[model samples]
Target chain A: MPVKSLKKYVGVPRDVVANFHGKQVVYVSWDQHLLFAAPLMLCLPPQTTFRELVDGPLAALIAPDPDAAAVDWSTVQWLKANQPWVPDFDRSLADNGIVHKDQLRLSTPGLNSLRPAA
Target chain B: MDMKTEKKTLNLKERYRLLTRDLGWEPSYRSADEVFPYVKYEGIKVHDWGKWEDPFRLTMDAYWKYQAEKERKFYAIVDAHAQNNGHLNITDARYLSALKLFLQAISPGEYAAGKGFARVGREFPGVGTQVACQMQALDEIRHAQTQIHALSNYNKYYDGFHAFADARDRIWYTSVARSFFDDAMSAGPFEFMIAIGFSFEYVLTNLLFVPFMSGAAYNGDMATVTFGFSAQSDEARHMTLGLECIKFMLEQDPDNLPIVQGWIDKWFWRGFRVLGLVSTMMDYMLPKRVMSWREAWEIYGVENGGALFRDLARYGVRPPKGWDDAEKAIDHMSHQIMLGLYQWSFGTSFHSWIPSDDDMEWLAKKYPTTFDKYYRPRWNHIKKLAAAGTPFKNFGLAKLCQCCQLPVVFTEPDDPTLLCNRETVYEGEKYHFCSDGCQQVFENEPEKYVQAWLPMPQLFQMFDGDVAAWMDWVSLRDGHDNGDYDGSRDQQNFQQWRGLATSNQ
Candidate 1:
């Protein structure tokens, strides 16, 4: 059954892109790493280039993992909306079609802390 | 058979009738529909509200007498505990971390349950359900009070216990539980019954109460154990009420089968997520372990809950949609949640630490297949970090599931190596979920969930992205109430006091 209420329950979404005060809220996760505990919620400029995110905030976030730096950036498969999508390093997040609350999953091959190679 | 003499000789059934059903009057000024406006519109067809049964048959006077007796006994123990220095009687200062978590998260939930029950009592057209709800509301408040009084014994000598009242409203982690109650509170009355009564109280209450109470007993916490004993009686009535509500709803009309099924599905998942905290408490928080979280889930969740669902099958109800996933999760969630809590301990009301060598051994033995392979290395890494003087702290806010309000810390059911990252685009805005269960809850009712007052958005947009302002608003004192437990005041002081109690040193 639909929600039974006196008034139509129309609510303004709390995390709309416009609510972020000019910063785009992008969630980045290293797919196999449980060490990070959760996908980091980052506030960055929508106009910020994909390369800048990977090299700047993303670098510092993953720097704690020893094997993270060794994984070649180009080989790191990116998942958006649960499907793989290659990002142009030169393109801005907005230009690359990443929106607010988008969980960009980084499935780094060979950097598996959960199932380490014997 | 004089009337005056007959009144004093009233039986249980007679006393119940006089106090409950006899008290409600037929309103001449307003129709019953107007008086009980919320009884409908959720599409539950109750042919007779009178079908709702109160098996306990307890009268208000009897309830008061019983509760007063329990209260007298409960507080006497609490006062004695304080006078005799019962805080020093605990296993260790680390044990207080579990107590601090209980106060900050679970106690306020009891208070919320009281308010929810009272509202439903008024809305249910039947006097039987109304009386049951009324008694439950009182039970909930009493529980909240006794729990506070029990844990307050620690507040005098503990760091994390100081700011729990304010922390319930404003803290990030407390929202895991706080939002669970808020979700139930915002729903209609019948939904409230299924959410709290059947699912939380009947289905999952053991996973919550038993482990903690036993952990309290094992840890030599007499006050908490007494509080547990006091509340266990009330829990029986609650479980009965929940079962009755489910049976009443289903047996009322065939149309209610699907509706009740949906609610069972929703609440069971919701209750499971909230109990992740308890699972962590059982596994990681208690200094003296009662049982592993996985074992408790097998006993309480899988066995007990499985039997309950089997009985519910006659009503066409299956186990929760999240059951299989939860079975997988029980092995992993405590480790994941503790990892998150430890990393974010700086933001919490309780201190978290790297486990002792004994604790790790216990974890390994308890979770043989998963622990050493998946979790031990991460703990080892943190141990190394602490050794090097930089204890691993995640200084950034974690993205939370919009529905459960928990940090998206859980992994995929099929693949524990990969994060169970699920999302949906509704009305041009994106919403994220940690699992299929939470995602389905949102998809079923996007209108209700979009209004979620998520903490990250509140922190960034409302608090101007200042962690200090956020902490100030939540009343968490930096470096005192939170962070690593090894060298903290709670650790040092407990060792000092307990030593003094033991010897001249």
Candidate 2:
């Protein structure tokens, strides 16, 4: 359903749509630590959520490595990265809100909070 | 009674409405979509053309009057600077390389923006959008002319300023700017606005303009400083347009958000990649630096960009995909790009110099995280080679990124020593990227980027593997225009000119 929204909204060709839907790629950024991670060759289904992306692909790639010392997985909060501005993350990649190649960053919940204090 | 005395003057808002909004006419025969076909393909759903706002309220009469006054003052300064031999007043002749880079790489981009805005001005359906774009179109052309006029005095004495249009099209380094504008021009009007207006002007213009203008003032190049200020006034309006365009598209339809967001992700990376040259120029090229590229990025990009994104939170937009990577790049991009340019100066139009011990010390202080550990050793090695009269340079052709078209010189994120090269096999051909950011860009539109015009591969093929033949093909005067600035004609001429001025005094 969200794939249809993506196709209708962006007007991407069916083949490109199929490629986006079939592939599992999410661009991840942690702004606080200046860490970015994206899978070059890996493919995940279109319906992958921010939680799944971080818990699955990101944690596997970053948590076990000594080089990812800056990325503390326990404190990570996901924010949907867009252009001109960024907004709070509240949806899956396949949701009508998220498009292919859309960027998401892992931050501490309060570090760079987009939500306003009441 | 005279006709001027008989006429009554209209207020600013009334005149603007009369000039822009009241001038629009619906197509009699052709449908709206038929008349404006380009906006549809980009999938930006603009329900009402009237929603597009002209923030400057700049009607043509006011536009011309304002521009003319600015031009008159700008040219007067240019004339004064030329008559006074302003080139000799600079901190060093080496400072002119930044101007040379600006002329060859950046001024041509302004021309490209002029052409792009002209096309989009006609193509967008809204009269307000059209008028705004047309004004910007003229502004961009004025920027190009002013920059060239400001720098032409130096051209009389320098080597690289000539044949910039040709060199920009053919040179490997200048291709970064060329391809960026070409990309924006080729896109639909909405995408073009998002690419240039939003990402470049709104988000990144300060990073490019502020430092260069201040650097010019600091180095006693008043002509360049004047031109920079002149263009910067116009840039404010352009930045407003960028912000308004993004908000207009997002507010129009829920569906439009994704399409606009996708563009933001793409163009932010593209613009950041192009700023590699600017980063190097700010940090390394200027004899008296205005600010370190790291400090500028933190102020203009990280701090300001973070604030901007927070404002857009309700619209569900976030920072660009490469936000973190771009921030990290402030530490290392200048050193990497400078090293690449220094090693390949013989093939370029501008001169290159090894960093003085003081310069290296400045770099280490600015880039505390990575400079001393990773990059300092390399510069020290190059210094050692220079002392031994070898002065290392890579004569071989480097494999360039398929997306950015830059040499694959970026380092791995974790290990700063290894080159951060990523390759993807698409349609049976291997595509290379300088980093994950660039690789992600290519993966987004493989069909579009597969057709990139990489100059190095083309030159290598054209010259049949001879770099000297390639140099001849590109018309770079090897000994005179290219190589070390220490003993170059430009340097010697500056020294002699200063000596003459001193003796005369």
lDDT of each: 0.89, 0.77
**Minimal lDDT window, size 10, model 1 chain B:** B1-10
Candidates in order, TM-scores: namely 0.97, 0.80
Per-model DockQ against the true two-chain complex: 0.64, 0.02
Worst 10 residues of 2 chain B by lDDT: B456-465
Please provide TM-scores computed only on chain A for all of the candidate models, following their numbering: 0.90, 0.48
lDDT for each residue of candidate 2 in B1-505, tens digit (9 for 90 to 100): 6455655889788899888756589788989778877787767788888888888898788888999999999999999999998878999989988988899999999999999999999999898899899999999999999998999998898788886777888888888888899888877888899999999999989989999999999999999999987888899999999999999999999999888888889899999989999999999999999889999988999888889999987899988988887876778888888887887788889998988889989998988877776666667766776787877665544557778888767767665544564766666455667889889877876766767787765653355446788777677888988998988999999889899988864
User: Judged by TM-score, which candidate is best?
Assistant: 1
How would you class the docking of model 2? incorrect
Task: Compute fnat per model.
Answer: 0.63, 0.00
Q: What local lDDT score does residue B143 receive in model 2, on the 0 to 100 scale?
A: 95
